[model samples]
Target: MESTKTAMEAFEKLEKVGEGTYGKVYRARERATGRIIALKKTKLHEDDEGVPPTTLREISILRMLSRDPHVVNNQIEMPLTKSNRLLDVKQGVNKDGKTVLYLVFEYMETDLKKFIRSFRQTGENIQPNVVKCLMYQLCKGVAFCHAHGVLHRDLKPHNLLMDKKTLILKIADLGLARAFTLPIKKYTHEILTLWYRAPEVLLGATHYSTAVDMWSVGCIFAELVTKTALFAGDSELQQLLHIFRLLGTPNEEIWPGVSKLKDWHEYPQWKPKPISTCVPNLDEDGLNLLSQMLEYEPSKRISAKKAMEHPYFDDLDKTHL
Candidate 1:
């Protein structure tokens, strides 16, 4: 216990960066190496059984994925280290007096949401080449996860971290991620953020697959181009409405089994709009790739690996990036 306390004391807490369902995040610097890291302090409930399921799941998935070369080499360049411990005097104390667990990760400068907001405020568009590079990296990371039988249920601009100097995009926040392999278990539709949530998930399909992540990628792609959320709905119903308005309402004919979803309802009928109409600046190839990702039918949605090969990224200088 004294050694754990010493280890925790090795890092100096810098500032609070953000908070989530599990815990608070802070920017901290190591006293020994002066290395910076993001410290995620997860609260442990006194009445709860053990470690939170989300934390266990995240730690396990990341452990398995951290071994993959594709993930370690290019995708979100952070090594997950659990050795460090910290005693939080403020928010870590439980009714039983047990301290919270702190997860240590290499520090990243910003996330995609903040990056997009900066561009929006500057009244400038992200360079098309930069978008291509970022999207390719995102697809690569997602592909690695899916190939490893993991599904990143929560994929959005806010969860995607980036190093401003290198312009490298990393997929972070695996709290909602799960393994989607054989003997599959039912998943909650209420997983991803509203704007990036897949249509099938929105309609309450509990038996979803990796295609859910693709839908989020499509939304992020559109956001990268327009510097705004493609479907910014305030509520779940409005979120569905936003999707239906743009892609047309799905039916038994178009998306088989969609009507059978638990939350399926008789939504207003609408015809699909041309992708080019909404993303006017997106070229033909970009539109084609985006359409495949945004397909209402989860089965029809393009896989992250397939998306990485789309013509939209044909000209990307992969070697340089």
Candidate 2:
């Protein structure tokens, strides 16, 4: 398939959405059916044999899971097909000779970052009720991924998308996601965004499981309530400092083998300030949920299933009740 012609045939380019390190996303319209889609065009890297591994991983996992409404509605508009595979799956080449990979997604108006900025600029707090709703939906998407044996290693505000009108939230960017329970080695330092990374990860502990994702959800929850990054820091050390400043330093009693982490030697041993000082504005119930979600021991973190059952959401109106 020719890159130029295939792109032209499948969808008409509307406008560029955002540029990443390796790709540029564009708003597009499907020519055959006139449906809007987000075309993610990635630049081929010869180092990795032209095809980007990130794109490949996303496509591979999405292919099997795309049929589910929880995953489908989040992004990747319309069902996929061979032609939508971006290039000749066999030859791995396109007409333009430049490797082209296409991921057709339902166009989103904005991301969580933009939405958060809007609310911050207006000096309006995200209502507890609204936060609860968004949290529930996010849990649904994360649970769907977990159930499918996928783990989104990278979870951040920029990757969380939303519809402008309805304020619906969806998880985007599965480039870092991997099939869960795969036999991989320990000490994989590919640390996600510093602020949202789990304590175990920052401590240089590998062999991590789905618990890393739970930590991200906790950070996101705190962000929603505080209207600021929960552990905003300039560097990895600073991020740890921020975390300890709030959650209190992890003593061996609280987190056995705390000193066993590969990088634990770097920071000085000190107890953290009280949790209340960390989030003075948050209510007890909100803080309770956040604390569980952000447990020092990944094993102690709340699962998505239990998170939804927390009493914090008891007041939510079911079915628009």
Pick by TM-score: which candidate is best? 1
Q: Give the range of the ten consecutive residues with the poorest summed lDDT in model 2.
A: 80-89
Q: Which one is best on lDDT?
A: 1
lDDT digits (tens) for residues 1-321 of candidate 1 = 123366467779999999988788999998988988888877776667766676677777766766543324454443322111122222244445775767777677899999999999999999988889889989988888888888888899998888877777778887788888776678877646898988877877778789999999999999999998899999999999998888988888998888788888888999998977778878889999999999988889999999988899999987633
RMSD of 1: 4.1
Give all candidates' CA lDDT scores. Answer: 0.80, 0.72
TM-score, per-candidate, Cα-based: 0.90, 0.86
Write down the TM-score for model 1.
Answer: 0.90
